[model samples]
Target: MKITSAQAWWVQIPIEADKQHVSDFGRLRTFDSAILRLETDDGLVGWGEGKNAAGSAGDYGTLVHLLNTEFGQRLIGRDPADVTYIWEDFYNGVRAGKARKAGHVMPDLARRGLTVAAISAIDIALWDILGKADGKPVWRLLGGAKSDRLRAYASGGWADKDNIGAQLQSYVDTGGFNGVKMRVGAMDGTPHRSAERVIAARNALGPDVELMVDAHGTYTVSDAKRFAYLVRDCDLAWFEEPVTGDDKIGMAEVRAASHMPISAGESEATRFDFRDLIVGRCVDILQPDPACCGGITEAMRIGTLASSFNLRLAPHLWAGAPCFFAGLHVCAASPASFMVEFSLGANPMIHNLSNDPVTVVDGMVAIPQTPGIGLDMNEAVIEKFAKKG
Candidate 1:
């Protein structure tokens, strides 16, 4: 069947917290996402979601406009089943030579940053359409099921200095997560403070529970190394994006200096960027987010690349529920995928946006067996949160 329409919805979902939370990038009070919906000639529909427009207030608008205009218009009457060709059309036709040569950073819908998020959601929606057309889930269509159950880590510990110990303890103690990740460099630019928070998290969780740290590309190589040294005693499961993601050499240096495995790739959007990261030995683990990295199709390719290098793929989860399930399916299909990320806080976007939201029980989650990504978007949630222009 031919693709009929592609649309983007911009919605601002409020966070359930009395005080605003802080991350390495910006404040986390409301989660704004650009959701994409694609329809085929036969009236079948697919849904996908992009990244959180936290810092850039207008990013959601840009995504919505781009998807509904250039990208949307270009895809009309095209075959949605040709996912690979469509990816190349956006990558080669829209990005690479044109944007890179001019240094204009063309609004290619599949590259890095905001535009790629739009591409990511649309790409996922296309896959959903394909899977729904067939009688299989996206993971099953990718290859075969590697495992029916996927393990997830509790992703929280924002505002590192603000009762982090209590926050971490509460996640594992009450939330039933297998592991927990906490932010490190958001408090101050000092490694000592990061070390202190790491120590607090470890002390609160004790030695048995798994603990991870994410600096969100906030530290220099030296500071990353220093903080890694200090947290070495804490036995961190991994150090995620210690230095900036673009700093391959610096990341490699930090990785070499630290005993804890370095995890990154959430900032990267394509397999080429992942190739650079893998070939450069920049990190021990790859953390690609499906929503930002060209969706499930590219994520599978990146997972294979990481496997060839003997590196583990732990899909990142910082977007909405659609993106989270997309990553979950990728993890379920790839045995090399170690753990998925689940936000450990009160995110109504995730909790209330899906009819069958994935839940963590004893730190593990089972993959949905239904067709496509096995989850449906809660239209009411979308309508309630749609930002007025």
Candidate 2:
């Protein structure tokens, strides 16, 4: 079957104030998502989610238009099964122009929203098509070794002060979680203050619980150094995104000075960018987001590179329907994957968007065995939330 049309929908989902206040890591106060839908001639449809942040609705809209109007034209009549070829053509074709480059040149941002998000949606759709074509789950198609179950980490530990410790305890009480991650670096706070928070969390979880700290790239080299040293006594699992995404040198410096394992690349887009960071020895762990890092197609390549270097992959995931499944498939197939992130905060989109909602039992997510991504979109939910734009 050939790809016939591509469309994108932007959905605005608001997070509760208490949830938003869980961590002061960044300026984001609301949660939003850009969902992409691809249609084929034979009536098969595939879905993907675009990576967008607060106040970035316009960017997602532009990306959808570019993909549907421009990139979609390129895919029309192309065999939906040729996932890799289509990805390469789109990468080389659309990214060659000045308009694309201009869009990519935003400060402190990776490539433009459209470039990464649009490609990510299409890449996911291609994987879905490939799974359907082969009559197998995406995990098996990606050569997954362990399909039974994959370990997961409790990702959203940013609840209010009184709830943070209890929230972590709840995850452990549920059983099967190998570890948990907590947010840090809010409001230009000093490393000493951040260290106190980490220490408190460690004490609450006790010495056995594997603790991870995500600075959200909000700390400077010096701040990271101080906090890393302080948390070293606490036995942190890893320190994530201590510095900005572009700061390879800073990340390398942090890696050199810190006792904790450094993890990053969530903000990075393509394989080339990750290659540079890997070659530079900038991070001890790689956190490639399937939605932002060119979807499953490029995530596999990144995972392979991380494996060659003996680096760990724990993908960054905090989006809606398609992103969760795409990430789950990659993490299931990737040998180097240490664990995948699961948000504590609820998103109705995640709960109701799929026919088979992704569920975590005893902290382990079961791999979907059905064909394609192993989950079908709930059309009723989509119809209710589909954006007119």
Candidate 3:
């Protein structure tokens, strides 16, 4: 179907004080994102999400403006099935033809940041259109679903030492998730303090449950190593973002210093960044946030990179409906992916915006089999939480 119109909105949902949590990103009181809607000439519509900030809080005005302006009219008259070409065209800018002819990227200087976020949104919407046109799910188009069921981990844990165990166990109890991830690093103040919390959490959960910690790329090499050493016997499933994403060498050093698996790249974009991580041996697991990264197309490419290099794929899904559902399809089709991230926090975008009700039963989730992303946007939710200029 030929594209007719593309539109975007800034959706900001407030989290109650009790539901709010603090980390290096500060108190996450609001969930923010740019949601896109792409309509075809024949009237079929596709939905997508774009995330600019790391965590859940940021002003999405610029992103929404970009999507509604530059990225919006540009999509008109283009085939919705041209997902990869559109992504490359955006990344390469005016040099798209040259890059395609040369079989190499001639990307713009504005390749990262909000540019990719916009591209990610459009790419996802394009895929959604493609899936709907063919009356098949996106996962089916991406080779095929490796499994009908996908395992997911509880993706939120932010309590202190005393309440950490109870908080995580509640995640397990609520969703039957045996594996859960908790926050560490800057939030805990010190490596030692974070280590103590990990110990305390382990003690409460016992030896059977899997524990993972994320620093949000907020650690120094020495501090990350120290914390890894302290948790050596805790049997952590992974140690994520041991150091800043910019410091790939530092991340590699931290990985080498610990037995725990190092995972990162939620703050990154495209396959090139993931290629660097693989080539540099910076991490054991690759975590690409679909909304911040290049949507499903680039995410599957990153998953291919992970598979080719023996690394694991676990996309960061702390996002709105489009990004989370895109992650679900990516995880469903990629062999390198072992689990999906199901947010345990009070995320209004994920829970309220999509008609798809994600049920994590016994730590596993069923992949969506319906056409498109297997869900429809709740227009009422969008209208209710949409931020106005």
| Candidate with maximal TM-score | 3
lDDT of 1: 0.81
Please identify model 2 stretches exceeding 4 Å from their true place. 16-30, 54-59, 94-113, 160-163
Q: Candidate 1 vs. truth: CA RMSD? A: 3.7
Off by over 4 Å in 1: 52-58, 94-111, 159-162
User: Could you report the Cα RMSD, in angstroms, for every candidate shown?
Assistant: 3.7, 4.3, 1.0
For model 3, where is the 10-residue window of minimal lDDT?
52-61
Candidate 1, residue 228: lDDT = 87
Per-residue error for 235 in candidate 2, Å, reads: 0.3
lDDT of 2 at 187: 42
lDDT of 2 by residue, 216-258 (tens): 8888888888788877888999988999887889989999997
Ranking by lDDT: 3, 1, 2
lDDT (C-alpha, whole model) for all candidates: 0.81, 0.76, 0.91
Deviation of model 2 at 54, angstroms: 6.8
Give TM per candidate: 0.92, 0.90, 0.98
